[model samples]
Target: MTLPQALQYLGTAVFAVSAVLAAGRKGLDLLGVLVIALITATGGGTVRDLLLDRTPFWFTDTGYVVTILLSGCATVVLLRWRHPSERVLQIADALGLALFSISGARIAEAAGLPGLIVVVLATITGTFGGVLRDVMCNDIPLLLRPGTIYGTAVIAGATLYVLLQSVGVPRDTAAYAGMVVIAGLRLAAIARNISLPALTIRDTDAD
Candidate 1:
């Protein structure tokens, strides 16, 4: 398979596994695990596709469904056998976000959308799934959380990818570079505890 296609499968699996682990933290049953896994694996892509007016890929791509199911079950088994560090899940999520962002940008570029739309699509693809996952689990969505740099990383990487592609850089090379941009930015933020400054609204006297 081509690099992008391979990343798609691997990213989907990683997301599915991460969702399974998250459900375990909630003491969910088997069905609950599967639901979370499927939602996390497919949510972003569905939104991206809908916004792009394209068919949702998971419906047409059987591999995505299979990977989600197998990865979910396998993750449960692995966690039961031995606990893995939370870092593993974080790294997996980073990789997934990187892959999805680039892929989403490519789709928008191919669809002849404006560069701004491309960036928006990429951010949605990278983050919307995790947002849904967190909401379903009754946790603060990562996109709303401080210190994550989640959507910013995706936007930065996607804008770079679109610019590179616009200048006739190769698709694969641009995509690879885009992934690095996101993963590097996100991991660095996590390591350094960096985040955008929070905004507070205060009432002022009308004097």
Candidate 2:
């Protein structure tokens, strides 16, 4: 399989694991776990496709569905039997976010989308699943979190990808570089607890 195709599967599986964890934390049943897994794995891509006027990859390809199902079931079974490392979750989150973001921007780039739109799509593809997952678990989404590098990391990588390509880098090379930047930045953020400053408005006194 092509690198991008492989990345797609990897990202889906990793994100499915994250979803299973969230669902398990909420005391969801097996069926509920599967539902969350499937949606969190593909929800971002589904939105990207709809906005791009293309059929969602999971709809056109049975492999995507099968991958998500197997990932969800295996994650549920394994975690039920034994505890997993938080590092696994962190690594997966970083990789999945990077791959999905890069792939989303690449798709838009192929369609001749503007740079700003490409960046937006990349951020959405990277973070929308986390948004859905958080909302499903009745928690605020990570994207909405105060002082987080999550979305910013994705945006930085995507912007770099566009800039590199504009400067004559090969598309595949640029994409790989972008993915690496994203994963590196995300992992670093997790490891270092790096965060952007939160935005706030000065409080006003009421009469």
Give all TM-scores, in the order shown: 0.92, 0.94
Candidate 2 ranges with C-alpha deviation above 4 Å: 205-207
Displacement of the residue 97 alpha carbon in candidate 1, Å: 0.9
Q: lDDT of each structure?
A: 0.89, 0.89
The residue-by-residue lDDT of candidate 2 on 1-207, one tens digit each, is 987688789889999988998889899999999989888998888889989999887977898889989989898789868868998789988999999999999899888999999999999888888888888889999898976789989999999999999899998899999999999998999899999888888889785
Best of the candidates, lDDT: 2
Top candidate (TM-score)? 2
What would you estimate as the lDDT of candidate 2? 0.89
User: Which consecutive 10 residues in model 2 have the weakest lDDT in total?
Assistant: 75-84
Model 1, 1-207: lDDT tens per residue? 887689889999999988898888899999899999999989998998988788899888799999999989988888777987878778878988898888888888889989998899899888888889999999998888877798989989998898898899998898889999999899888888899998886869786
Candidate 2 TM-score to native? 0.94
Candidate 1 lDDT: 0.89
| Clash counts for the predictions, in order | 0, 0
